[model samples]
Target: MNGAVQAGYAPPTGPDRPAPGRRWLRWLLAATVAWAVLLAVLTWVSVRDDPPTVREQRNLAEAGPVVDRAVGELLAAAGDGGAARLVPDALRRGCRITPFADGATLTRGVEVLLADDDVRGLLQRVADRLPAEWRAGVRVTGEGPVLRADAGEFVAVQGRSAGPGRVRLTADTGCRPIGAGYRAPTAGGGSEAETATELLRRFGGAEGPVQVSAAPCPDGTTARTATAVSAPSRPDRPSLPGTLSQFSDGALHVSATDELYAYRSSSTVVAERADGRVRLTVSTVCRR
Candidate 1:
């Protein structure tokens, strides 16, 4: 047995051995990489449980449907007296989805007509209205109130007050490999054509074109909106007051002026003069 005080020279097994700290550092790096792999695998397995289908397999192009559905949920949460539109923010900036490849994200927006004071109430309503599975909640921040939730299929939903009398809701798909480019989902069918024709005739202006868009409602109904532009403003405009009188029964009105008229009758209608042309819009009103 060698004693602590043995004065013999120690035998060398090799040129030099790795430092203990260096060996531990190597293990640390290996464990970090293994932990990352495990996290990725767990994410994949969890996504498979999301209803409808697994969301991670979808590319930016294929994620449109999920985003559109999320928009519907957001709008429905805003209640029936809201006029909303898809204000897309299709900026796919660069991100590192993996060490070897660049990734991208898809963000779509819904711009709703919200008064300044309505911001808080609306955000709270959305938090409550979103599906129970989403774990929706609202938190006040330095900027303002931010409502965030999970829209199934790996989509994140957020709503914030954009400006006075306006609120913007966004659905975002975090970073992912740029599997394919993006294509917007097509709007559903609605009777916007017919309404556009009638409204144009009433305003004594011919309809140039009509664009219709529809989204699924929280109540399992298809909410539709139709808009069209009329020719140059006509002198023989139908009496704005007289025309709206028909829908005046038990309806809510706003912005009644010679240039702009907005109200919620059987549906929500807003007519305003834009660039000397009258642009009219009708949005679906779901009666709670």
Candidate 2:
């Protein structure tokens, strides 16, 4: 080990080669990471949309009963008055309050959907399907069990403001006792039909043409129903007064009789006193 300056060159003490397979390992590691990221991205993209599938379509097709039951259940969630009280927003939206059709299968989009109890799609969708009269130009506001309706006149129900859409028609309809409760004179089963007949007989002074049909009761029964007798207006004919009353409780009562006819639904009642001279036409529902 001479101390003389070793400027010529230095001897290599350690191995001059790089780590064995080091580059290959790094390349393999990089490839693995890239593959992992790509897999993760692909997986995310695959699940992002999750659109309805063939199985879902088939399930929807087979889900007719399910959809029907769901709609029924949701509709049934309403109270005794009718669907209006049960689901006002839904009723206002587009939900058509109709007699539950027998044997009709419901589809999600094709028929109906229950949606969710918390979500409003059920009501929105139903509202979308309603006739123009129900949703016709009306502004609605507020919340909860009570609703309000204001158009030409201010109408409030339960406690909420009833929008213009709610004022045009009714949803909840139940049968009420009319005239003196009479025992059945005939042997036929006591029903809405019998009630309608008894009402006509008891209040027989009706001079105008009267029409009757089976009315669907709120309790899921159908009976004889009557509407105003209509005739073509003649130049000499006197215009009859139309009697209609509304109640905050969502009831309407109308009455038209030779002497007097009264009709009531929810909270409204209309009475027409004919006194045997003036022909009064009243429309209403009576319990069997």
Candidate 3:
């Protein structure tokens, strides 16, 4: 047979070729799949459930008993003045049950917080038994100080124990509330003149003594000696015009040419008047 015919008739065998690109592509795909699976697992783990409100409620419920017991102890210690301490806590916490019985009062939850679980349930029970307004008016006698506030007004009972003595209490009428607390004058017993002076200092720009010059006499009229009048230690603007004769009406009447001025020093007033002129005066009640 011819060579060409013989080669054509015989089956030819080919050499093997390496598939490196296909192998690399398979490895890359597997690594990508593994990374994707890891990310999905991490996301699931990070987003686990945590309910803050529910937890807070639970804590209150648990601490209810402890708080309730504390209230009882506080009331017993307070005796007649127990109501004072309870008022501030009730106002702050938003929940309290004050019950009146046998002419004596009992405080249940003035400071109860949601963080305690036991107290929360007790408070809820108290709420269910009492009317809503009762919570606002729960008064435990002698528990609070006069400075403790209620609603928008700051109620202070000055001279509650003054009997016949004079004591002064000041409420910063001009001061507005900041956050949960009011910007009232610091609590302490002082004469009304002193309190007024402090309020004026805070309200008005004037501080220290206000000095005044005496009228000068003509050269032939025997020139009067020059005199300096020290400002009144405490001055308050009164609801009504003060009596010109009396220095303190719990108020002061300032004039364009008046020699007297008022100021405050340590919740008290020190009045210094020009000789032959009336000295400043005021009245006050002592705190019981």
Q: Per model, how many backbone clashes are there?
A: 0, 39, 39
- Which stretches in model 1 have alpha-carbon errors above 4 Å? 1-57, 81-105, 114-116, 174-189, 203-207, 235-245, 285-288
lDDT tens string, model 2, 1-288? Answer: 586656787654457755657768989999999999999998787668654233222221233223222222223222112212111111111222244311211111111111123223233433433333333222243452222221111111112223321311222211111223212112123343333333333234334544432223334432232333223333443322222221113442222333333333421122223323332222222221
Best candidate, lDDT-wise?
1
| Model 1 TM-score (2 dp) | 0.65
Off by over 4 Å in 3: 1-148, 151-164, 171-208, 211-288
lDDT of 2 at 20: 51
Superposed on all Cα atoms, the candidates' RMSDs to the truth, in angstroms, are 7.1, 18.2, 23.5
Each model's C-alpha lDDT? 0.70, 0.29, 0.27
The residue-by-residue lDDT of candidate 3 on 1-288, one tens digit each, is 555555457444334543668679989999999999999887676545532222122223333323333333322222122111122111123322223211111112221111122322332333333323223222223732222221112221111111111111111112111123322112233244343344343223234543221111111111011112223333552211132324335532222124433321111222223443323322221111
Which of candidates 1 and 3 reaches a greater TM-score? 1
Model 3 clash count equals: 39
TM-score ranking from best to worst? 1, 2, 3
Q: Model 1, range 210-283, lDDT digits (tens) per residue?
A: 77666666676766667778887677765565665565567666556666666665666767677767777777
By summed lDDT, the worst window of 10 consecutive residues in model 1 runs over 80-89
lDDT of 1 at 63: 68
